[model samples]
Target: MFTAGHLAANPLPPGIVGALGLGGYQLLADIAGVGAGRLGSQAFLLVAADPDPALPDAGTQISLHQTRLRDESEAAAYVQLAAQLGYLRLSGYRLAPDRHGLRSRINLVNPATGAIAATIPDRAGGRLLRGGPGASQLLVTAGALPPAG
Candidate 1:
């Protein structure tokens, strides 16, 4: 289970509750390796819960619902996403995990401008960022790594 940090428990909004009742949205996570070169490991953080189906579709809709989601679980998801973004900003990899392997092309975009701030490219192309303590916000999925040499 993913950590919620300091988020407190609260009642969820009607829209989210209804959507959950209807069934939709899924909580997922991608874990990255901590080593360098070919000596690294990776994992995933996936939740059985899903997002509210009635919840908005576009970024604008999600923005609107952000203010409405008071439930601890819903708010936690936002925090987790934000943490993941922060992790990417620092010295970590941003992974999009699948059934067999992790994805390399992951772009952390500004939800507001849709402008690409930090771009993580495929194993053959991009380089990972580096930072100090507190740099790692939340553990992220493993960006596609080059094959073992």
Candidate 2:
């Protein structure tokens, strides 16, 4: 998980950010990435997985690229570009102001199919539930993620 403090402490190189299609955004917690270790391949994959307490050994795993953006409009453009570049699994949250108040939401986009997997309002004490193709349902919460066992 890469938090804002972590980023501030050890900033990522501009090249990495650009390569990941994560420019103009701030990274938050609950982040994970995978590289072709020892496979002699340059492909990298970033993803997040949440286990469902109701079903042991079953949960959803989606490509995770958590970011804090200004609004959905800005995020749409980034997501589109990332998808076009073959970023099949990209997900993040957006925080924007509204007349009622501040609005926050999470979006999971399957860039490969050009479809939105899920969208949930970002709020404290809430859970974002999702299931990948042929995978069990997963539970994601707005609160701090449970310590990995």
Q: For each candidate, give its TM-score against the true structure.
A: 0.23, 0.24
Q: List the RMSD of every prediction in angstroms.
A: 16.2, 17.3
Model 1 per-residue lDDT at 14: 46
Model 2, C-alpha of 68: deviation from truth (Å): 22
Model 2 residue 79 distance off true place after TM-score fit, in angstroms: 24
- As for candidate 1, its clashing pairs are 25-50, 25-51, 30-141, 31-141
Give each model's clash number: 4, 1
lDDT of 1 by residue, 1-149 (tens): 22342111212234633642423332232222111111011111221121246853211011101212324454344345434543443433222221212222334444445454443332221123642211122223312222212
Q: For model 2, how does the per-residue alpha-carbon lDDT over 1-149 read when each residue is reduced to its tens digit?
A: 32323223444446545654544433322222211111111111222222246645311111322233234443333333223222222233221111112222335444344344554332222123632211111122322222222
Model 1, residue 136: what's the lDDT? 22
